[model samples]
Target: MSVTPHVVPGQYREVSDANGRVYRVGETDRSLLGRPRAWMVWLPWIAMMGVSVYEYGYSSAEAVLEHAHGWTLTETFWIASIWAVFQAGVAFPAGRLRETGVLPARTAMLAGAVFSGLGFLALSHLSNPYVVIAGYSVLGGTGAGLVYATCINMVGKWYPDNKGARTGFVNGGFAYGTLPLIFVFNYWFHPSNYKMVLDLIALGMVLVVAFCGMFFRDPPKSWWPHDVDPLNRGVSEDARRVAKRLAKNPPAKGQFTPMEAIRTGQLPLMWFALVCIGGVSLFGINFQVPFAKSLGFGPLVAASSAGVLAVVNGVGRAIVGWLSDYLGRRQTLGLVLVVAGLAQFGVLWSGQAHNEPLFLIFAFLNGFGGGAFYPLFAALTPDYFGENNNAQNYGLVYSAKLVGGVGGGGVAAGVVAAWGYAGAYYLAGGIAFLSALITVFLRQPGAPRRSGDGSPVAEVGGRTPSPAEATT
Candidate 1:
C-alpha cells in the first residue's frame, strides 16, 4: 500500500498516517526562514530572560517597593499576585489570537516589549496600588505573557522531533536570568534610586525583547524536519536516534483540537497538576526572601538564596529536560514534583531552625524541583496532543498558572499573616504532593497502557479515545 501526500503548493507537502495525523515535510528551516532553526531557541531564550524579573526578582525588590510606594507589606505582595494573574491569564487568549492569525508573532513581541517597559515605569512612578495594578499588573503582565507564551510555543513549533531538551533550555532563561538583578535589587536599590533602577530595567527589557522578536517566524502547520521521515523509520543515524526517542515518548495518535484534547480528560488533569505545582513554585518565588529575612538572616543570605534558586531553577530545567528524553516525560514529571514537595518541607525546617547553610541547600533543591516541571508540562502537551495546534493547547494548560499566581502570591500573603510562615509552607508542600499524585493518572491521550499483568494493551490502537475511555 502506497500513501499519497498532498502538496501545499509552495509551502510543503503534507502526508497523513494511518491515524490521519498530518506531517508537512520537505521544507527546511533555512529555506523558509533564511537561517537555521537554532535561532528560534536562542532568540526566545533572550526574550524570556528579559521578562524573568517580573515574578522572580520581585521578591528582592519588595522592601524597596513597599518603602518607595508607602504601601503595606500585604499591598506590595498583592501587586505581584495580580501581576501573576494577568501574566498567566493572557496566555490562552494570546495563543488563540496567534493561532488564528489575528496576532502576528512580531507584533506580539513588540507589544510585549512596550508593555513590559510600561510595567516597570508604573512600578517606578505609581504610588497608588490600584493604578499600579492597572498599569503594571494588567498591561505589563499581559505583555510578559505574550512574550512568554510566544517564545515557548515558537521553540516547540520549530523543534517537534526533540522538544524536551530544547523547551527546557529556553524555559530555564525565565528563571536564572534574574540572578544579577536579584542582587542589585537587594543591595543597590533604594527609594531615591529605585525610580532610576526600575526605569533602566524597563529600557533594557524593551530592547532585548524587541530585538529578538523581530526575527520570530512560525513554521508551517504540521511541519516536520525535512531530513527525518515522521511516519516511517529512515536509515540515517540521526533518524535512528529520533526513532528511539519517539518510541519512548510516543506522539499522540492524532492532532487533537483544543476541544478534543479537553474531552480526552488529560488536559484537565494536566491543568490541575499545574495549578497545584505552580502555586507552590510561585509561593517560593514570592516569599523565600522574606522568609529568610524574617529569621534574621543577613541581606546576603537572603539574596544569595534567591540567586542560587534562580540559577539552579534554570539549570535544572535543562538537565531534567534532557533526562526526560531518556527517562520518559511522565515519569520525570512525577519525580520532579515529589522532590519539590519534599524541598518545601526542607525550606521550612531550615528557615525555622535558622540554619543558613541548610537553608541555601534546600533553596537549591527547591529551585531544581520548582522550575523544572514547567518545561516538562510544556513538552508533554505536544507529546500528548499534537504539535499542529500546540500553541492553543499549551495556552489552555499554561493558563492554570493564573490561579496558581493568585493563590501563591496574594492568598499566600493572607495565609502567612493568618497561619504564619510554617503553616503557609506546610500548605504549599501539601499542594505539591497532591500535584505529584495527579501525575499518576496522566496517560497519553490515545496511546498504549500497561495491563494488570504488566503487558501492553492498546488503549485506543492509535485512534482518538472517547471521554469515558480516557478517564479510565
Candidate 2:
C-alpha cells in the first residue's frame, strides 16, 4: 500500500443522547493506515515486547552485574527498585501530554528509544553504583515507562470493543518478550563479555521501539467503533455483543478530566488496591527464583521456576482478558487476587516441604494470578473513567506501581532481613487478601441512577426529573 502525506486527518465529532451521555469520536488509526491488516495493534505489541526484556531479563543477570560493578545485593536491588520508580512515575505525565496533543505518542516512543539506549550504555560503562542508578534507573526507567504507557494507551484507544482481549494480548508481550534474553543471561552471559551483551540489548531496544512506535497513534477520545451501534438493531453478532456489554457497563457519563476522576471516590480505592497487588507481584518477580534456589532445588528446577513464572505470567494475561468479556472486569480481578494470595502461601508450603514439583506448580499459579490482574486494571480504568482522559486517569492508577515497586523490592528486602522469606511471604499473602477484599467496592461512580420506572438515567441538564422508564 502506498502511503500518502496528503491524506487528511478525520474531523472531530460527538454523539449525544437525552440522558446526557456524550461520546467524542475520531478516525481510527486503521483507516489512517488504509486498514492495512491491523498494524496498529501489532506495532504496540512488538514495541511492548521490545521494552520487556529490560525489566524481566535483569534478574537473571543480577549476579554478573553485581560482580562487574562490585555492588552489594541491596545496592543492586535498590537500582531495580529505583528503576521501577522512574518507569511507573512517568506514566501519568506522559499520558497527560499525550492526551492533550502536546506530546505525540510516536515522539514519546522515539525518545524512549534514545533513553533506553543510553541506559544500556551506562550499565556497560559505569562502575559507580550511584551513577549507574541515575543512568539505569532514571534514564532507562523513564525510557521504558514512555514506551510502556504509549503502547498500552495506543491499543486501548484502537480496540475499545474488545479491549480486554487486545489489552491482554499486548500486555502478554511484556512478559514473554524476555524469554530469549533470560536464556541468554542464564547460559551465555558472563562478566568478561557483559559490556558487548548490554550494547547489543540496547541496540535491539532502539530498533524495536523506534520502528513500531513510528506507526503509533490514538483513536480520538470517545471514539466508538464505526460498525457497532448501541441504539441500532441488526448489527453483526459481534457488534451486538459489544453493544450489550456497553449497556451493561455504560461509557463515562462525560469525559472527566483527571481531577474529576479523583473526586469520584473510587480512584483512591483503585490506587491502594493496586499498590498492594503490584507490590506482591513485584516481590514474586524479584525473589521467587532465589527462594526456590534456597530450597535445595537443582539449577534446572530453579531456572525452570523462574521461566515458568515469566511465561505463565504473560499467557495468563491474555486468557483472563478474554475471560473478562464474560465474567466482568471487577469480578475477574477479585478472582485473580484470591488466587495470587493463595499462591504465596502455596509457594511457602512447597518450600518448607522441599517439594520441587509442588514448588513449580505454585510458581505457575503465582505467575498466572500475578499478571492476569494487569489487563483487568487497564480495562477497568476505561470502563469506569471513560477514554477521553484515560491516559492521565490510568496513569494515576498505574502510578501505584511506583510505591508498589518500593514495597516489593526495597521494603521487601528489609522484611526478608528481619523475618526471613517465609515471614515475608506470609505478609505478602496478607496484602493480597486485603486487595481482593477491596475489589468488592469497585462500582463505576458514573453509573446511571434509577428512576421510578426502574430505568437508569442521569440528570445531565439539571432539570426536573420525569418518571423512569423500565430497564433491564
Highest TM-score scorer: 1
Which portions of model 1 miss their true places by more than 4 Å? 1-11, 447-472
RMSD of 1: 6.9
Q: How does residue 84 of candidate 1 score in lDDT?
A: 89
Query: Model-by-model lDDT, in order?
Result: 0.89, 0.81
Write model 2 residue lDDT over 5-98, tens digit each, in one string. 2323564234454444554333445555566426767888898889887777777778789899998878877888899999999999999899
TM-score of each: 0.92, 0.90
Worst 10 residues of 1 by lDDT: 453-462
Superposed Cα RMSD, model 2 = 6.2
